[model samples]
Target chain A: MGNEAFLAIGIFVFTYGFIIAEKIHRTIVAMIGGALMILFGIVSQHTAIEHIDFNTLGLLIGMMIIVSITAETGLFNFIAILAAKIVKGRPLALLIVFSLITAIGSSFLDNVTTVLLMVPVTFSIARQLKVTPIPFLTSEILMSNIGGTATMIGDPPNIMIGSSVKSLSFMDFISNLAPIIMVIIVVTVLLLLFIYRRQLHTTAEARARITDLDPGSEIVNRRLLIKSLLVLFLTITGFFLHQTLGIETATVALFGAFLLLLLTGENYLERALSKVEWTTIFFFVGLFVLVSGLVETGVITRFAQSVIDLTGGQLLPASFLILWMSAFASAFIDNIPFVATMIPVIQDMGNMGVRNLEPLWWSLALGACLGGNGMLIGASANLIVAGLSGKEGYPITFMKYMKIGLPVMILSIAISSAYIYLRYLL
Target chain B: MEKLFYMVNNELITLTEHRNENDFEFLIHTKTNEAADRLRKLREFFDSDRVYTDILFYARKDHEYQVIVRRDVYVPFVVHLLQLQLLKSVEWRTV
Candidate 1:
């Protein structure tokens, strides 16, 4: 490696280290690293800009807007209450229902947003039932990560993957990954149910109180809810047909977001825009440029070649390696940056004679997304739920979460390994 | 303890205090969303993780808001009510 390559490596390592250490805010660390790369002439300003994926950023902003406004309608709370009532407030049944709701919600919405909406309600329900909310909260965290693996727009990693690889469309993600996701969700929930079955017991009177709750009353604004639902449904439908229509997923998402804004009038414009996670968007900006330095310095290609040599240039071993590695790495570190860096590495693998790169991409997605279930700090959603729960006086300690999360993560990845080998390799 | 009435944001807010063995429950009845919004702001303040106040907010029908404030949180909750201009003055306690 030359001077530029060395510098790029140094900057990349520095950025990754700080991001993991997390003493400094990650966005600031990534932004500074990207700046250093440009300052050192590792990548030109134009080249750095070119590397930033607007599609991923746009899709994130669009979805954030939609979810932010939809949340104001109290729809999530209504759904949670409705689900609890449907199960007649049985704690075991409610646990399963809440997990399913969280998974399905994470499939369409982002995991943090899904949990943000669900945690308060989960606490309220648990309080009413006189049971601890740990099981419900942990199940939601795990299922959110798992369910997000099933859809292109579900998780940040998947969004990055879908945008980078044009061949993998919204429908493609659903068809390819949703099957395994369904199985994982069922198995994980069953395991969680068995573990928490004893604590789920409640008085008959408590059950009656839940049944008496009017779910409809949770809907704060009827008009806003109708408009939001309509737009959401149409947006999801647009995602399904975007590939067929020859449009980008970002375009579809942005269109849906603006349509909701227009329908709701300019009153919501400021509020919705304010709610967009600008910090996360900018973090993506910095990461793309930071990774671009490696891409420009030929580091990614070298890494890809090393992987090929290690795996004997075989697709099966390479795919399994990516899957398992991604799962464990994502469990401990931020998966978004991991996925961002891996996207180009996988692309380089494609160039280096990995005939079928499809399995590798799927493996990376499965590993990075599912790996988040391995520990409390594995995913953003986990931390958010934990923080919220801790504030509410029920703390989810790292070891406590890992006891359940680590095993579930390993089991899910094992299932994924089997699925990949049987479906594609065999 | 005592039932009190105050005018907040030009709307009447009726506060009825129910003393429990461990905490106090204050039933806040209002006729408009503005009062509820203000009360929500108070709830939000106490709900923050940084604050060590133990409070629970229950949104009931007919514009009724119930707040269960623990003994430890009562002082802070009352201070917030005064700060939000919902309590008029701290003298309401003595009254």
Candidate 2:
């Protein structure tokens, strides 16, 4: 009704339109919306930048550097090789091992890291086995989201969700959802085996083609490797000790990375810096400004209140409500920005006496994250993996990813929803 | 040791500062003495034949590198050396 509300609608409209047309990059679209919000005086410039969530950025950057070092060490490669060796050329066994390892990494770190660190290595093994790597990658990506479901720091959405709700913790992930996470992992592997069985290499020639086949490797620098591993170990220790030591995750990670740079002794410091995707970071800054405008315009708060009333202050029904909407929204909207805006909506739901709606937070996080894999433009990790795959000569068209990704979305959401309902509600 | 030839743009590939673990001799198409010398040395290291007791170059075509692996064990060891070489070379070309 007010000028601010009008402006907010305009920003949202522009964001959606810009994204849909593909005329502007998402960072630019988000930046434009955020800039417009500030220009219209919907939110002050300070809040616009301030709301961008540097915690997420810091965690991501810190982890990327650490993961890069680990990747360079060929630890990930060695792990995949171990899986391949342990599977001993069994397609289904390799699928399970690969998926489980990827899920574990994704849960602790994030999907993009897990994927980046795992995919190429997976590709190498798949090449050796003379089989298609798609099923393994698909399962990995899906399991990544599902695996991220089990841990607070596993996914950005989970981190955001956890930070917004205090009843949850790093430990809570292991205690509350570990069983369900395991269930999803088992189901995911089984589903992948079934879905891709026909594609499995059974021909005698193809079978022979895989035995002791070639995938690339790197020259091992034991000094560099040991040094990098030390830094990584320290980083993990710092991360776990934070609650008692009263340290921040970002500070620990940043400091650890700095130490690694000092000790790595190679030119990888600069190379590593180049590896950080500032594009995604800027996108975050831009999206925050855009979402802040929506908040400033009072539209978001109003929307939140109405939704709260509609749910009759019941968290159980609200959990379902948020689940479906978040899933769909995630399919279309950028999950980071979506998660950013929903922080307030979640608070609004809380204010309406949705007691222990904390589990609802998990649903929102898992739903959006898993649902993000639904479409081409869902998650940052999706775009990254797609681009990486393409760079490696395996171009992943939107249609192709969606073919597998869509079914993955449906199954993951159903499983997650059932888990949340059973865990939280009657 | 064995030499496997992988000719990339007419210049033989070499991993300058890394240890060799494969027997590969190859010609790659490229212009640079460093590239040629590196390739030749790699071939010598990997070459089991020991054909060249003297220094000479073939008159035509491109540069070739000789790469040799120190031992024989499989599971993509040679592939690793090739990837590292390719990855470094590719990174160099791009930068």
Candidate 3:
């Protein structure tokens, strides 16, 4: 390795250390690291700009706008209340339904936002039933991660993967991963139900209170709800056909977002844009340039070669290794940065004679996304839910969560392993 | 504690006190969605959890709503009402 390679690796390691330590805000750390990369001539300013994936950033911003506006319509609350009433306010059923709703919502929206919308309603339902909200909260956290695994836009890892590899489209993600995700959701929910069954009972009168809730009244604005739903449906349709139409997913998402803004008038423009999570957007920007340092230095290429040598240049063993490693790593640390680094490594693997890179990509996606269920600190969604629950006087401690989270994560990964081998490898 | 009735902004606000063995509950009937939304937003600002707070909002028929305020949250709730300009003034008494 030359002097530039050494500097790049040093800077990369230093930046990653601070990110993992999390004492400083990650966005600031990443920005400074990315600046250092350019300052040291590890990567040129032009090259750094070239490395930032606008597709991922645009898709995130666009989806954030749409979800933020849709939330104002009170549609999520209405759906939660409607689901609770449908199941006759049974705590066990409420748990299952809420988990399903969260998983479904996360599949199409950001996981943290999905859990944020679900937590308050979950607490309200639990309070009415006079039961603990821990089971429901925990289940939603796990399901959000799992659901996010099933689509190109579902999880950040999948988004990065899709943008990096052009051949994997929205429909491709659904066809490839959605089946397994459905199975994982069913299995995980069943396990959760069995574990928390004893604590899910409530009084008959309490059940009646839920039934009395008028779901229709939860719709805060009928006109806005209709417009939001129409645009949302159209945007999802655009995603399904974007590949076939030879257009990028980001184009479709941004088009939908602005179209909704036009219809809703200019008043919503500032409010929707303000809610676009600029911190997360900047975090992605800094990470892209930081990783570009390693990519340009050829460090990632050499690491790829070593990984192939370790696995004897075989696809099956390599795929399994990525699957398991990603699961455990994602469970403990931020999966976004991990996935960012791994994308190029996997691409380098493709160049180094890994004939079928399909399995590797799928393994990475499944592991990085589902692995979030391993611990409370595993994903942003988990921590958000924990924070909200703690503020409500029902803290989901690390150990308390892991007692259930670890086993479920292992079981889901096991199922994913079997599915990958039987369907793709074998 | 007693049942207190007042008029603010041409709207009737009734506060009914229900005494438990150890704690007291104040049911503040706002009787309109506009006031209910304001109170709910205030409660949300104070307590993000929305349910476990000393204040809870219940929706009644004809767009009417009632806010259940516990003793601990009474002062802040009253202060919010004053700030929102829904309450004119709070008279102090030596109960």
Candidate 4:
């Protein structure tokens, strides 16, 4: 009815259309939309700038820099070669280890980056093993997403939610959710087994083939390895040390990145940063303004509150909606921006006295991260893997991915939902 | 003018078209002949919406080739199939 309301709605429609069409880069669309929202008075420039959480941006940039430089040290290649070699190119064995590494890595670092670093080496390993990397890669991404869900600094969505909720602290998240995540991981592995049962057995003399492929002899950089390991350890420790030492997560991450830069310097670091996907970062900044407009106009609060009243505080419908719908929605749209937008909606639901909304947050995290396996564009990891691997002649098609990923995602998310319902809400 | 079909003994899945900036690595998990056949078909026509079309073939390469492989193993293969040529472009699958 009101002009501001109409403007907000218009912004939403435009953004949705641009995202779906995808002819335009998502970050560009978001940036333009954000700028226009301010120009149209949907949000004041000051308020829009205020809504931009530089802490999240700084963390994303800082870690990206560190990851970019560290990955160049051949550490990622080293790990991938080891994972593949340990399995001796066995698909089942490879799946378990790759997923474990991805999940564990994502829990500390950004999930997409974790996925990105692993993609190239994983490809090399699969080539060596003479089996499809699809299953192994899928498990890694799924695990990364689920594992990333446990930590506050793991993904952009978690970072946004963590910063928004005053009562929610890093310790609270790890303590409350980590136990449940363990159950989630087991269920995830079982789902992988169930989903890719046939692929597991396809391991024919791929062992010799793996040795033949060589991946340039899996060069071991012990000194670079030691340095990368040190920075990563300090960064992970900084997550827990934040409250007491008063060191910001961004500071630690950037510090690690700086250490990498100092060691690797610009020549090597540029190559790594090229892989960082600043477009996604801009996508974040843009969505912040677009979503902030609704918050500015009091629309997000109103919508979230109204939904809470309709649910009568029942956890079932809200939970179902959060888990299933979020997963399905993420299939079409990029999950990072989508999840970033939902942080406020979930937080508002909490404000409306929805008890146990933490499970709801977990649900969103599960759907957004795992559903990425369902389609190509669902997650940055999928895209990065595509970009890096595509150069080598293996092209992952949209339909082909869905054939494997759809069944896997459906079962995995369902298993996760059941796990959450039984462990927390039930 | 120039097109070729090479069997990959490697696990990497690739899709390329004759024209178009859209390119990608596809994930293929064909457990049976039929499954492999279908994946070959899909990768062949993946870029129908894009510029040019090509034929494809699916065969297990007996060994690493004189050729080069450039895709990521762990990435979901579909994300980059936008540029894969169809199997029709290839005359046949060799050993």
True contacts recovered per prediction: 0.00, 0.00, 0.17, 0.00
Best-fitting candidate, scored by DockQ: 3
Sorted by DockQ (best first), the order is 3, 1, 2, 4
DockQ, every prediction: 0.19, 0.04, 0.33, 0.03
Cα interface RMSD of each candidate: 4.5, 17.6, 2.9, 10.0
State chain A's TM-score for model 3: 0.99
Which candidate tops lDDT? 1
State the lDDT of candidate 2 residue by residue for B1-95, as single tens digits: 44433323333343332333342222234356655444434433432232221111211223332222233422133444355354232221221
- Please identify model 3 stretches exceeding 4 Å from their true place: B1-54, B60-66, B79-90
> Chain B of model 4: TM-score?
0.26
| Model 3 clashing residue pairs (backbone) | none
TM-score per prediction, in order, is 0.91, 0.77, 0.93, 0.74
What does each candidate score in C-alpha RMSD?
3.4, 9.7, 2.7, 11.0
For model 4, how does the per-residue alpha-carbon lDDT over A234-307 read when each residue is reduced to its tens digit? 77778677767766666766777777767755676667667676887788788888889988787788878766
Compared with the true structure, what per-residue lDDT tens digits does model 1 show for residues A219-277?
76899999999999999999999999999999999999999999999999999999998
What local lDDT score does residue A22 receive in model 2, on the 0 to 100 scale? 68
Model 4: lDDT equals: 0.66
Error of 2 at A82 (Å): 2.0
What is the fnat value (0 to 1) for candidate 4?
Answer: 0.00
The weakest ten consecutive residues by lDDT in model 1 chain A span A211-220
Model 2: native contacts recovered, as a fraction: 0.00
Return the number of clashes found in candidate 4: 44
